[model samples]
Target: MKASLRLQDTAIRYFLEVAQIGSISEASVRLNVAPSAISRQISSLEDILGAVLFERQPRGMKLSAAGEMLAAYARKNALESARVVAEIDALNGIEKGHINIACSEGFAMDFIPRTLSNFRQQHPGIHFNLKVCAPAEVATLISRGDADIGITLSLSPTKDIKVEYRQPSPIMAVFHPTHPLAHKKTVSLSQLQPYPIALPEENTTVRQLFDICCSRLNLLFEPILESNHMASLSRFTAFGGGIHLSGEISMRHQIATEELIAVPIRDRGMDVRNIEIQTLSGRTLPNIIKVFLAYLIVKMKHEETIGF
Candidate 1:
């Protein structure tokens, strides 16, 4: 007996590439095949499956209902295939694999690197790829299967992404320990007015939360400086230059080292954010990823208990 589908078939590979790229021309460039060839392959796949996979758009292809289902199937099959190969390698006394992670800059600055360093010490053969991106882009990477894991502070819920872990991550007032507000158990938005505030861009989740809170109270503020990089902002506050707004996790190292202090903001709107660990929906992750994920959860939980 022979299997109905062959894993090495070029038609399915082209179809999946087109589905991911959303354009035959783009997929052609990536796959080093002619656009016509990719088109023919996708059309053949549609005929064989008896369903129109994509709705032809003027600019590019949009996956139809059938396309989405098939994409999901392809992703799961690819992950399973990789897992089997890794298991085989392990049986032969070889251990090696790659894990891709996409996350916001907040985590990249300290926590993620620390975690990865520790994980590598345990499994030296397991490699990693880390992508620092916007919070929303983290979800996009996960949904597209470009990343195996995503850690981000989310402003709103995103669809087609599974939340593996979640914790309340509030926008805290970050400043040098010697700053006047540092001694307070909790500080409100009104109390933050006097100091020089260095804020992230208005588009960031941290800034949005701060802006919403100020709008409700009818308070006005002009930041001394605005930046997209949270690391720079944290550094500015760490040197006692000014105050910055961020989550505790982003400045965890700074707080731990006593270089900067993170005081909770006593406002409901400012507290309305969460740190989420995300993955593609309906996908079974590789065993290596599961192990790393458990390690991440334990580390994060331990940090929470320490009360930075």
Candidate 2:
């Protein structure tokens, strides 16, 4: 019985690690076990469950339907375990816990950092683990139970993410105040086409909307610079030659400091994006996460009302 139980635990652990990392070799490295051992454990899990968990692909392993189901179960189990630990800590009168948050680069720039700083002032014992990624990966991390909270720009509803708070995050024209279009209250894509542009990569929601709008008008504008990092793009725009597109909230600090100006874009579909505060669906959250969620929502809303 002991041996069987140990095998089951090992199989589940290895399987979950593989599922999260999406590669047996990478999971082995992360788990500090041999790739062959991880492979064997996964095979044992597949045999016991009588289902193929992963699809072997040239690029990497992709989860099969059965694997996705198992992954969901494992994530719920892990969250429940954390809740138990938190409860025990609370019983011991300890005010400590870790919050894992995943968000896109835009939020990481100023809003999240400031919010975290202010939150720690009251709950200094609490710690945070923040992972910055693309908008889609933020949802993936939350759904997999790797992150306790997810804040991102979503073009549509995700499969298993629950939106605790959402606000419209329209993309705006971000540039230095001295730029030719800065004096205008709103700018059009065609009006700005004559100047050099710095744009986010094609994968981002901002670029997607811009592409769709351009496609509709048969307009063609090639950016002088393209990057995934919001900081780099902001800095490039700050140097005073070109403009970058971003949500007003993302660059609120810079705008307040008089380093940049954000004008509403006069294009349709530019306002289709939303900033979502997300978590895994149907999971009971720890008190620490609940408090922080409320705090974050209030802060975001307050900032939305205050002008630059």
Candidate 3:
């Protein structure tokens, strides 16, 4: 777009800094540049665009009418610039970059860490920032540019969000290997009625499925312990006590080690849903991120096909 052509990258940076912090001095401290240098850049930008970008006040600067319009263009340009930098680095056979991810707590437990470790073996210089969030917030985080990618269950499609990959990720009954129903490979809603249970909070997708299935089977649902944290639920299930309901992937490590067991909740399609890999729509991703994303997608697809 012609939006970024109005000013040099430095000028756009300076203008954005002032607009964000509402003060040149604050932005200078953050940018590690002199205040006067930032001021001169802002002045030059305004002159070039022939629009007043800020309104100076005794308190602090504020965005003018023109400033708001430039803000979108400036941030988009900056993100594109970062993409360009990463691509240039790739040309030299370098795979160094930092990627931020926001995802569901379920993926945070096992899938993400394992994937990150595997990917980094090929590009040790690549770093990752992972944050646990609800599935519903995944699209928002990517669209708002808070994260490079999102991995979450039951992620809804949106206009500004692109689904890179999605696969079946159903809720399951998780408990200790020594538990009564542990010998069984799968369980029905009726089977869980007799056990003391640890359930995720009602807001979570796992709990929502549990509630819906129980209602369909005319079963009463009660939990001895309810929490939003997967680790807490995992630890509870690790001990010799109640069965905790969760997605199979969240506790796959424990299941593999025999610290816990995961049994699918039985139904024709009761817990049917997808785990989605997502990104901001129409944004060109950095090569480093693209590489990692491709690996993640293929790995996840493999999991779906073979229960990895």
Candidate 4:
């Protein structure tokens, strides 16, 4: 059979819903299909695709490797179909729907709130489910269809995830106002050598970037404290124990509150990973997600241009 003929819409949808819910019974409930119907459709889909989609477990079904690939394709196709319908609806001037997004805690706390608040005001009928997680976890959530959108620092792309937006945000040194280095408008990596530093834990992207930069400058970067959480890092910096490095946006509120001073590390060329907005490749975002992404792109561009 032809590849197109092998995958029917009903089968594809059943597979997609099952993948989303991670259980045949739950998918049946969500899609309003009988459990047997869902199972039969998924089995037919597996046969057509020439791969098993799920493995039975005592509690729930788990996706097999083949299932993951097919699920990604199914999600992309469903999203595209919805986008087409939304476009048709737009001709009648009716805007609607919800968007589920997964993002890192840093962006969730500072950047996303303002942008989403603005989006909600403009499209009150649209709903948002924002899940805050680490960058790797955010990527996994999007891959599993638990989230429609993801915002995170640039990393190696997963098989079908597309990087839609990448905004460069600088990593700046933060210190309490009373700290000696806080008086300097710009500091070099060498200037920080004398002070104890609070840094992200070793495996994180931020810590890796900081390590690479310091190594290039032949500067010693021994941290007195380390944490995976940005909030904790900021608190440590604010308490006057040690300096910390963080994204400019993540520390905006604390800086405004005068709890800490942010100094640009001019000589070290302190640039953090490119902030990215990602979606499954070949997919169309829902109207709410599409609009929110457009808004985010605009806001990030504005911030980039204005040096925020």
Give me the candidate number with maximum TM-score.
Answer: 2
Q: List the residue pairs that clash in candidate 1.
A: none
How many pairs collide in each candidate, listed in order? 0, 0, 0, 0
- The parts of candidate 1 lying over 4 Å away from their true place are 1-8, 155-157
How close to the true structure is residue 3 of candidate 4, measured as C-alpha lDDT? 62
lDDT at position 177, candidate 2: 86
Off by over 4 Å in 3: 1-75
Tens-digit lDDT track of model 4 for 1-308: 67666788888878877776788889888998899998898888777777788998888898899887777777666667777887777777877776888988788767888888887788887778999887777777776667888988764656668888887766788889999889797888888889999998765667777888888888887789988788888887777789998777787677778888888887544674678888876676766577778888898888778766
Steric clash pairs (candidate 2): none
Residue 179 alpha-carbon offset, candidate 2, angstroms:
1.9
**Global fold similarity of model 4 (TM-score):** 0.77
lDDT, residue 58, candidate 1: 100
How close is every model to the real structure, measured as TM-score? 0.91, 0.93, 0.77, 0.77
Model 3 agreement with the true structure over 186-260: per-residue lDDT tens digits = 888788889999888866788777777677777896789888888998898787768888878888788788898
Sort by TM-score, best first.
2, 1, 4, 3
Give, for candidate 1, the lowest lDDT window spanning 10 residues.
1-10
TM-score of candidate 1 versus the correct structure, residues matched by position: 0.91
Model 3, position 241: C-alpha lDDT score: 65
